[model samples]
Target: MDIQRYLQHIHFAGTPKANLHTLEQLHRCHMLAVPFENLSIIYHQGIHLTPAALFSKIVEHNRGGFCYELNRIFALLLQQIGFQVSFISGEIRARDGTFGPPFDHMALVVTLDQPYLVDVGFGDAFLTPLKIITSEQQPQASGTFHLEHDGDYYSLERRNGDRCSHAKTLYRFTLQPRQPEEFNGMCHYHCTSPQSHFTQKLVCSRPTENGRITLSESKLIITQDRQRKESTLHSHEERLAVLRHYFNIELNVQAA
Candidate 1:
């Protein structure tokens, strides 16, 4: 991959080094610039796991993607910039209080002064990488997150604030190194299976400087300073306009 071109695509201007500051900046820039979207699945455009395909779709075509596409490409960018990055498997926590299958999600572990959990594809997640320390709350603009360890697995949890009664567990992962191709099955499942959420709805979202904007189904929800305002999109033209205006995506597909 062309590292400079990729950096420009993500709007990362400075010279990147493999330090914590650079990592943080890159992560934040990526979260702001590249949205977390599943438009391809809705449009019947197949998801390809190759690096060329990812870079072409995200950078060349100016589009966004879900976890597998986003995290894999971001990992390649980090590796090219001299960071020690590894792919790790995560099982997402379902609403029924059960964890999904292993490799349900892909995340990164970047080793610098210490190992830090880095993820840009989990929509509305921590903007900067969280240090891999269990029980220590790592506060971010989005929310407060912490890692919980149980034997070989580590669970990432988030809470709105100290007043929140329960901490939501986003997903659980292990330190075991993974290969990008190993996630292909789950990626394909997400793109094709009826049980996967990607196949169920059209969601495109990204974080802004003060808040986040999301287009789910026919609703456009913008949250600023913790206040949310939602608008219902009535027509395909309106939905397309919202996608272009809010997420900077110009999709040619009809509503799914």
Candidate 2:
């Protein structure tokens, strides 16, 4: 990996190599810098899975992407900076709530001094990687997350209140190395499937000084703890203006 490009993409500074400090730094940097976006997926371009291609599109082009693009790029940067990293795909349970096959989402299962579930692109996910061993409720800006291990698989559960909602058996991964190309089929499916959420909604999310700002379709939702607010966009101007006003994303992406 090109250190310069990695640094430039994530805007990492003060250190070049990966350390617990730098990892924490990079983790925060990634959370701030790169948005979890899927515009390219909606724009009719095939999602690129290779690290080289991922870097070219993200770092070189200044584009944001979905989980596959965001996490894949982050994984490479970690490796380039000398962190022990590995790739694994995640499966997203359907809204109707059924565990699909593993080709649902792409994620990473990282092993360091201890195991961690590191992902920067899940959008409003765990602020820091969840300690794989910690079953206690880990607090995040988004919500609370806890991991439960069952046999050989793990489930990531996210909750906002007493009610346990939005639980995704995120992914089941082993300590095995994965090539970027291995995610191509799933990536394509995510980008192309009409049943897929990405194909139906124009969504982008980022962390803000207060809480989080999420643009779904045309509605803007802002939440800081129990205080949640929303606005209904009536026109393109409203949508474009709202995106810039909050999330800092430009919808008018130029074509190649």
Candidate 3:
């Protein structure tokens, strides 16, 4: 992979190092720059898990992807920058209070001074890495997060409010290192399955300096400092224009 090209793709100009500062900067840069999008699924396209294809689609074409595509390439970028990274699997917590299947999501267990959970794939997530080795509430630009260990599995949760009673489980994962290939089946499932949310709508979102902006199908929502503005696009042209304006994505609906 071309490390310099990937760095440019994320618009990251900071020094790359195997330290917290670099990790945090890279994490925030990637999250804010590359959106968490599922446009390919909307176009009935298969999501490729290969590193070469990921780099081509994300870095070359200047597009974003879901968990597998984003985390895989991000892990490689970290490794190239001399940070120890392990590809790990995460099971998303469903609304019904049940965890999804194994490898439902892809993330990284980056071994820095202490292990940290790093993910640019999960939409509407924290802007910085979370300390997975601790139970202490870690404050972030987005919200406070913490890890809860239940035997072999670790649950990563974010606080919905200032108190602990509102902790919401984002996803559950184990520290076991996994190969990128292990997620192939579930990745395919996410893109094609009728039950999958990615297949249900067109979504592209990214974090802003104050809050975030998300576009789902024709609805556009922009939030800044807890205040939000919502709008709807009545035409395809308007929707595409919103994508280009906010996420820097130019989509040819027919070509996608």
TM-score list, all predictions: 0.98, 0.85, 0.96
Best candidate per TM-score, number? 1
What is the descending lDDT order? 1, 3, 2
Q: Write out the backbone clash pairs for model 1.
A: none
Sequence-dependent TM-score of model 3:
0.96
lDDT against the true structure, per candidate, is: 0.92, 0.72, 0.89
| Per-residue alpha-carbon lDDT of candidate 2 for residues 6-82, written as tens digits (9 for 90 to 100) | 67666677866655667777877787777787777766767767778888777776667888888888887788677
Give me the runs in candidate 1 sitting further than 4 Å from their true place.
none
Model 2, position 96, has a per-residue lDDT of 66
User: Any runs in candidate 3 off by more than 4 Å, and if so which?
Assistant: none
lDDT for 89 (candidate 3): 88
| Runs of candidate 2 exceeding 4 Å displacement | 8-11, 161-176, 253-256
Error of 3 at 223 (Å): 0.1
Residue-level lDDT of model 3, residues 107-184, one tens digit each, is: 998987788899999998888998886558887868888888999999988885686468899999999999888999
lDDT of 1 by residue, 64-163 (tens): 9999999999999999989999999999999998999988999999999999999999998999999999857888888899898999999999988783
Residue 154 of candidate 1: its Cα lDDT?
95
